[model samples]
Target: MEFTEPKAYTRSLIPFLDRSHSVAKPGFSRWLVPPAALCVHLCIGQAYAFSVFNLPMTRLIGVSQSAPGDWKLTELGWIFSIAMLFLGVSAAIFGRWVEEGGPRKAMFTAGILWAGGFMVSAIGIHLHQLWIIYFGYGVLGGCALGIGYISPVSTLMKWFPDRPGMATGMAIMGFGGGALIASPLSVWLMGKFASSTDVGVFNTFIVLGCAYFVFMMVGSMIVRVPAPGWKPEGYVPPATATKLITKNDVYVYDAIKTPQFWLIWTVLFLNTTAGIGVLGQASAMSQEMFPGHITPVAAAGLVGLMSLFNMGGRFSWASLSDFIGRKNTYFVYMCLGFALYITVPYAGGSGNVVLFVFCFLIIVSMYGGGFSTVPAYLKDMFGTRYVGAIHGILLTAWSAAGVAGPVLVNYIREYNVTHGVPKAQAYNTTMYIMAGLLVIGFIANFCVKAVDKRFHMKTDEDKDLGAARAPAGAAQAVPGRA
Candidate 1:
């Protein structure tokens, strides 16, 4: 192999950290990319399980219970909300930067912010300050979440052009499943570190920060972009593009200007609102709806099972989308999701725990599938050129739903209960409302059509911003090839 002399002032002392330096060489296997993506996604996915820290944090001052000086649960709730809000804000703002910069740079920045967020939050807990935790995990860590989330998306799609859905599903699946590992690990860590005077929240944050940092860095190190014009062996380009799947690229800003963008945004917003509200209230809703049957322990178990369904749906639904077409896949989500949401209250009323559980499992799975499939959906509607940035803008729907879903569930349930609706019946209206939202999503999904060609990129330079260029003499990339 030929080697070039090192430059006097390299972009990074470790050259691989730089985007240009991280290009995969000839013979590099595309399969390695998914694990690299998982390293970052799995670590960032802990955002879902951050709830595990909420209760423990309340007892930090009291050790055994919430004391006078302990932080209130209401205050702690803002931490996740703020993190989520900033996640969307940062994604929308920084999407183009990430797309142009390459995954390695984005992943590196995400690693630092994410790990540092944990470290700073740990300091906040130790000092008994709440805003510090918000600033740390919320603003800083939230930025990390946004960057880490979209970094691998376009890269994966380019690498697996034939199976874009499945390729992205593998990476996004790690994000959904991250809570599975983090929830139990966090509880065990707190148990080990707890004593009469401390609940170990601070220690747990520190450990998690360090551990996540290492994993994210590893992902950054291994990540690479496919050389431009590279296609898998024996993979022929589609001679004629489908109505939705265009060969042309759309600039990121132009994508936002399209009606299709807003439609997809609304579709995502509604789908997430329906499920996220229920997801946050799952444990309490189960206990209240099926009182005397689902104990707190069992409700917690249900939450864990929902997590699995969420994780599985991301992979399964996205892979299925590859076969069925993205539009048909979303139609299934909206249609079937509407039916499932409608059944939840009926199942609860009939006191059929099995049916109730089944409804939610499918519902939560669709929620996750909505997330994983959308990237490919955007790729279908818009071209892959600015897909990552377009996806970043789309994530704002998630932030809006994050707030709307939980608020709707909590306030509506409270309104009913205060007005003498039985606790068991409080969620009936919420379920109906969720079903209605799914109906709106279905309408929005139906409204979607092919994007106009007027918005398409006209020139070759406009299509690719130099990031896709292959290194000289490098062989074309092939999936699963070593």
Candidate 2:
């Protein structure tokens, strides 16, 4: 409302603006940002590949005892969960910094802290200190998650204002695929460095920690946002595009006050919870349920396979959202996701591996799609002004889902284990619960109206002019990867 074309020149929240107030353009290339930023994403995606290291970390501590009774599964788990707690909380807390510091600064910070976390964990293993590993990995991993999650979406949207979903998807898809790379890497590193005699968990931890730290830093140098004032060549948002949220272009602060923010938050929370619940304990769940046939390692391989599904989903589903619109895509994911969850537990005595894999992969893609889609939705609803901040805030839902997902899967598995029911049957009960959450999400997605009419910023002149001056960065925003 304060923006005045005729009377005054003011700071604009548009992606690339300079001190002189001339519009900025993509400094280098928009499409280049995704591949460069994906380095950080792949590291954060290690969250999916967590189970690969859990066994080694646990054996270094809990399972090292001569007897089964000596170890506690609960203690070993605290490290990973503690890290995630920070991942969610830090994103919102540091989101402003992420925006101000520029993507390069943020990315470098993530690379150092995350890689250092591994080194710290390695030391903890060598010195036989469990708490140290918790502190080192927890805080550092949290930082990585915060930055990696935001970088590509923020940069991509700036470059590809018109197709925000596809741009974000291309970058985030790498994040989803991270576990695919990590699972194999973790396996190889563990095998190579593992002390043959004493369960050399310490040595393996050190080697891997160092390796990841070095690998992540390479990408940090390349990550950057576009120059100010860049828009795609020749294209402009129609008066139609401006009419939707133009007058209502609220600041991130103002957006939080609106109902739309909360509604979308709820949608993201449930979507993430449904996917993560299955993902966290997948291998263990698979082995426990199909103990006669599937080994934990094979089940873990299946989980890695799910990572491929997760990765592909981010790219394909989100790219599709650019065409179909985010709200509609979410409708499909949630409504279908609810049904998928319902089918999962009942996979039953049929011994159908194919059916199980198909169902799980669909769910994983939905989860990935939800993430890849939301930033564009944020751009649509909140305007680009505070979108990065708003999107960062929304990720708090992911943090919440992180806790909820594992708890739901593990608690049910534990309860069933205690009751002497097979873990597989117990998993069925959890799936039913997941179905209910997805139903709730589907309902929430239905509730998001176009940004309230009052918030629209399209003026008579803006309508007449109609994005004739869309910044130079627009061209960088290539279409969905066909």
Candidate 3:
């Protein structure tokens, strides 16, 4: 479908929604874009906190309620799984479309789909239909998550070419902290809306959907694309010739053809796989490791604390990447992450709670850092022209890791338990496996090299053709010669 002017009534409004037409005034600070990006991210980042609804959802048709049977945990797990699976699929499929559509249109569409998913879920809950809930939250909402997640990344990198890491980091960090804000807020809202006749989850969904719609619209309205060739005042592109940074553009279709893309994909897949493995079992791991010492409440608190590290790492490590370069940054993540995973068994065996928690904290922060830095890394390798689409395709690694990590860890633990390993020791095998994954990621990162000139969009005509095919906001003229 042509992104320029869709025939559908809803999509017809896209041109009006295009913020790129609004020229930035003189001295316009690029700083404003991060907050706008954050508005959308902070709202949609609530996906991380979806677990807060798991218990309430399972009981939706339970003994306490009027219905006959309760939803099983396994059934509810599919809800989240479906959402994540679609998040990757939609992101990979719609990435180029979003690039063609521009941030305003992309974010606006995401808001509608995400918010609408919740409202649909409310209907599903009211009707007590699992499939309806799946369609509503899993399919529609998951698409929203994918679109929203990548929406700000490319824009931020373009606006802050001088410091892409810091810019993207600021926005992506909201994704990590989103649970911090949403989890408690969901609990509070559910309680506030609850009454004798209702558990209040349905009402909470309605309220959250409406509230997110408004919040996301604020981002869509406020976000503006930088004019063609615009740059920050006094900013200068680095002069050093290195394999890590580039000035050439690669089309999205061409990006996937390169070995660099797959290498980075593997790097991301391994890092996320290892990190998420630990994250999925954080509370359980904590309690099991220190059977008598760590209470369930304390373990829960540790989970929350890990979130802080995850959020903080997004900003800190990404910013650090600006100085060290993207490849070096991943080297740190993989090498240190491997060491950290290896130490978890020791920490847990020795009953050193502080050391165990600290090790995981650093690991998760690096995990988040990996996410925030990858867009800039893509820009460094492929140029900003198709960064959005490239990043979108790359997120399939995340989708794969989402499933791979938990399943790998769980399977290992189960195997160990079956062999008479203690619950605390069960995680040891999993930790070693995670460390091995990181070793592979380290090798992938080490092997990364510049994309060959054959893949580069080499001519002015080629650049123009690329731009003309995309929406006005989606395409920008290459930065003018300094």
The best candidate in terms of TM-score: 3
TM-score of 3: 0.93
Q: Which pairs clash (backbone N, Cα, C closer than 3 Å) in model 3? A: none
Model 2 C-alpha lDDT versus the unseen true structure? 0.71
| Model 1 pairs whose backbones collide | none
Indicate whether candidate 1 or candidate 3 has the larger TM-score: 3
lDDT of each: 0.88, 0.71, 0.86
lDDT of 1 at 62: 84
| Best first by TM-score, ranked | 3, 1, 2
Model 2, position 267, has a per-residue lDDT of 94
**lDDT tens string, model 3, 150-250?**
88888888889888999999999998887888999999998998776677899999999999999999988888777766788898876764777888888
lDDT of 3 at 80: 84
lDDT of 3 at 56: 80
Q: How many backbone clashes does candidate 1 have?
A: 0
* Residue-level lDDT for 183 in candidate 1: 90
